[model samples]
Target: MQKIKIKGQDYQLPIYLPDATLGVARNLDSLDLLQVGLEGVMVNTYHLIQKPGEEILQKVGGIKKLMNWSGFVSSDSGGFQLFSLIQKNPELGKITDEGIVLYTGPKKQKKTLFTPEDSIRMQFALGSDVMICLDDFSPPKANEKRIRESVERTIAWAKRAKVEFEKQLQKHGFTDDNRPLLLAPIQGHNSHKWREFCSQELQKIGFDIYGLGGWPLDEQGKFDYSFCQKNAELTPKDSLRFALGVGTPENIVKLFFMGYQFFDCVLPTRDARHQRLYVFKVDPKNLNQEILKKLTEENRLQEIFDYTYIGKGKFATDNSAISQFCDCTLCKKTDDIAQVSKAYLHHLFKIEDGSAFRLASLHNLRTYTLLIEALRRA
Candidate 1:
């Protein structure tokens, strides 16, 4: 496991950060996140500017202050959000080397230029512990030419983002010891050649961390481990890598051994809200490096990892905790009071109660933290 300091706070590697896209992790409050043992959260720079807007964020002294959160905060460059919007409907905007040109207003004629420099500046204003550079995402089925163009643009943008990042550090009077970490995503779709090239170029510009950019899913929507493995290899042995938007419990455990130390994804919390909760078939406390390695090596992760869909009919009358291993509020009793049982949680969801979301989210996130605990030991 790796350990690093961000803005004077300590963080152990192989850490997971849930997405709080707009400075909030959906139904849960900041204290709830801390209670679940989460070390940090990833916020979106794109959505924040659209919602609370920059004026309010700066006035309130950034997201940490705005949310009254004390945990580490990582900010997305907002490049993916813009790219996704344009990809869904090209008439919305276009990607130029200079930046993403988005067409706003009723007629879609009003133009807004969102550049790499703008992303860094906004993230600094948000006072994030880790800041990602804006990058062009390569589509899975992108042609050879398109993939090459994506790599070129990603490298170019990373260069500009680095310049802006340094400028911001100096402006804010931050030193190397106290400055936030900067990450640049490597975009190459499935092409190892382009991915390697992107990595080499970004390394020359020298980003603090390299992100696994683009979708790791194959054309058939299956998770592509080879794609992730190749991306990890592109960076140096000791370099830090962020598995951006990567999935599932199995994915996290598998990727951790492959040399990725940082991860941020929406699966755990999102799945909780959707009534699908993750659980370990065996207690995570029983896991260790040798056992986990044996399971990974023998392709037995499925045996140890599983999920509980709280909405199922069988769960409607089940009185057990969501997970026997989970210490979340819904799973663990407080001062001998009975914890919320699976049956009660199922009823909460059945009746459309908002507390169901919060309770489920807490359980799921706790489950993730438990896994993180086991991995750190590994």
Candidate 2:
């Protein structure tokens, strides 16, 4: 599998699955909907282990064979979920020198322990092309002391994950011909100083890539464009720089200009489910008079397309319009929003329809894939 190099950063472009179970259930066919040139897929380590379990994946000949996906695949350490669990049920998590232990699942039925080493070992079993290290995440608004503590823990975990990965490679007799790469994550909520420090430290450990700028940038507005710009500049040039959990088209455009080479997030697909389509062009010139009037006058257009309240009455259409314009197969074959109407999508939100969720998800995934192609050209 060839690694991608952009502006000196090396990465295997990832097609991310926000949830492993959903990804597996959707199966390999869903990948056909990706834009023509997508490079890889990403799955969650936590969700896979909880639902299908690592053993099932291994028996099915690893993630690649199970999904029948030929391209590269990467798995995230369950660190983010651990953070979420701590917030929701503080009593369910225990932080130790080894790692954090958590009680997971419905009815809190199962107990799973996730140490840095454990994260690496599970990823090894799943046979991902690249695996991320477990890192501590601090909220963007966290006090300086807490941020520092989280940064230190993240560094510690990076070192541990590296040591464990190296040992695994040696045991498996993995030469450069066949060795899985590990991606070290940079932590430090909104503090530029801490972010730089974390990057510098992780560079010394020497992982294949870096997962830059975690959930903080999303949760809080503290780290702006300049923060991402500086962090991308400071990161090692040879390793991949992936801005995790950032997929907004506008944000991606800004980050691409800042030298970021890779990214993964659920926003595109998640937002698509809500009937929000992302079009690159600036606000349509005749939005109010022409588009709105057409929509109001025609029953179908009014039924399918309408002015968006979110973007100051910008013309918004269901997945069908955006999909039809897109080159992806989902749009080409289905021809009209995969048999679901815009009104149905809107109703899905009002009544919560699972079918609408699937349709919207497919559209969003295609939209993101298309956006990446556009960025690559630029």
Question: What is the C-alpha lDDT profile of model 1 across 267-299, one tens digit per residue?
Answer: 888998899988888888888767887889899
lDDT of 2 at 86: 88
Question: What does candidate 2 score on TM?
Answer: 0.77
- For 194-288, candidate 2 gives per-residue lDDT tens digits of 98899889988887778874653545554366667677777755556777776565566556555566676766555655556554232222233
TM-score of each: 0.98, 0.77
Error of 1 at 368 (Å): 0.4
Cα error of candidate 1 at position 244, Å: 0.4
How many backbone collisions does model 1 have? 0
Candidate 2 Cα errors over 4 Å, as ranges? 1-22, 25-37, 104-112, 216-223, 282-320, 329-355
Which residues of candidate 1, in runs, are more than 4 Å off? 334-338
Candidate 2 local lDDT, residue 362: 64
